[model samples]
Target: MQKEVLIHVRGLQMMDAQGDQEPIEIIVPGQYYFRNGSHYLRYEELLDETAEPTINYIKVSGTGLEVSKKGLVNVHMVFEQGKKNMTYYTTPYGTLQMGISATNLELTESEENLQIKADYALDMNEEHVADCYLAIQVQPRDCKDFVL
Candidate 1:
């Protein structure tokens, strides 16, 4: 089963001598959960090495619900885009410790109408680790739009 997610993005521009690039700060309310029989608990999901990843990122996008709608969805995350082998996050858990390095985040149109799929990978350092991937997909609503 799949669900919709509400993601909040703040506009930000990073400037350097080369040029100025504006990226949005994404605030996503996580909603993915795992059940351990008696109780349904918040759980973390990771990506196996089968998916190839070049750069590290923190990505979030749509489910099987949004397809072929440009600007209707967003696959947002943070990482050094140009640099190769640059790690986006590494064990930066302040109170709780875990690094979910998302990469290859892609959202594309499928053959089916209004149905989209998002794919990405999580860089997990250990075989058995804490579940830190907090992802929540939600219903769509009208939000204020901003431009760079």
Candidate 2:
């Protein structure tokens, strides 16, 4: 796929069991860049032969670009499952963080000549996060590869 089509997502999830709330799942869509500043991302549905509870879609649009993503999101598949972790990314309620198992990430935009690299960890912290890291690079798709 091209480098200008991506919708990144990261946040916490809550589940209700026995009339109580608990942290049973997480959504870590990795980090991305558009270079154009802001963009849009939207998703309606998706399919994954493996993961049963596959993610429907992920959309993002800001000031520069737009994109849609679909697939299964397993924190355990991407994270190391930390110790009773509780994280947040939206609203004015609580903090947001997640357990990640990303070994290494490298994204290089051959067009824009940009790149980024990141590491993985069992635990992370996001006391006050908003998760507004969606950028866009519209049309003609002109950019380079980037590393996570």
Candidate 3:
């Protein structure tokens, strides 16, 4: 992918015991780069009109994926297949302990695009909350074939 890109992120969270919820989707312009055998993506996410946008940084490598967010919210999350990672998630309302246990992680890359799909379980405050799926697709900004 090029340095200037468009990113489409689709996420689904299903209550472990309750059921599935509607999926959330977002498309935004972003910056992408490759360094030291890792891919990096930077983007700003607007939580709402009244709130400041959150800046997100994602790092992807062979072993795992890391996401760090700043601004309106702050968090650093790690995902590695078959491993449970814990971290603190801070938001305007308050902070909570968060955990991610990834069951599957797939990464596909090409000269013009990149795709990532992950399936995991989520825990909040040390209790199992949900099972989640995340898919991220990135293409060069100038690519005419790119679509949400």
Each candidate structure's TM-score, on Cα atoms with residue i matched to residue i, is: 0.20, 0.24, 0.96
Model 1 Cα lDDT, one tens digit per residue, 1-148:
2222233323333343444555434444323222331111121222335433222122323311111111212122332212212122222232222233333223332221111122222233432232112222232233233111
Best by TM-score: 3
Cα lDDT, all candidates: 0.26, 0.30, 0.92
Off by over 4 Å in 1: 1-94, 108-148
In candidate 1, the residue pairs with backbone N, CA or C atoms under 3 Å apart (3 or more residues apart, or in different chains) clash, namely: 4-137, 4-138, 5-137, 5-138, 31-135, 31-136
RMSD of 1: 16.2
The Cα error of candidate 2 at residue 102, in Å, is 9.1
Query: Rank by lDDT, descending?
Result: 3, 2, 1
The residue-by-residue lDDT of candidate 3 on 1-148, one tens digit each, is 6799999999999986668686999889999999999999999999878988899998999998888999888999999999999999998899999999999999999898899889999999999999999999999988889754
Whose lDDT is greatest here?
Answer: 3
- The 10 consecutive residues of candidate 1 with the worst lDDT sum are 63-72
Model 2 residue 144 CA deviation (Å) reads 16
RMSD of 2: 12.7
lDDT of 2 by residue, 1-148 (tens): 3434433233222222333322222222233334344222232223335444343322222211112223343222221112232333221244335543434443344443333223333334733222112122222223243223
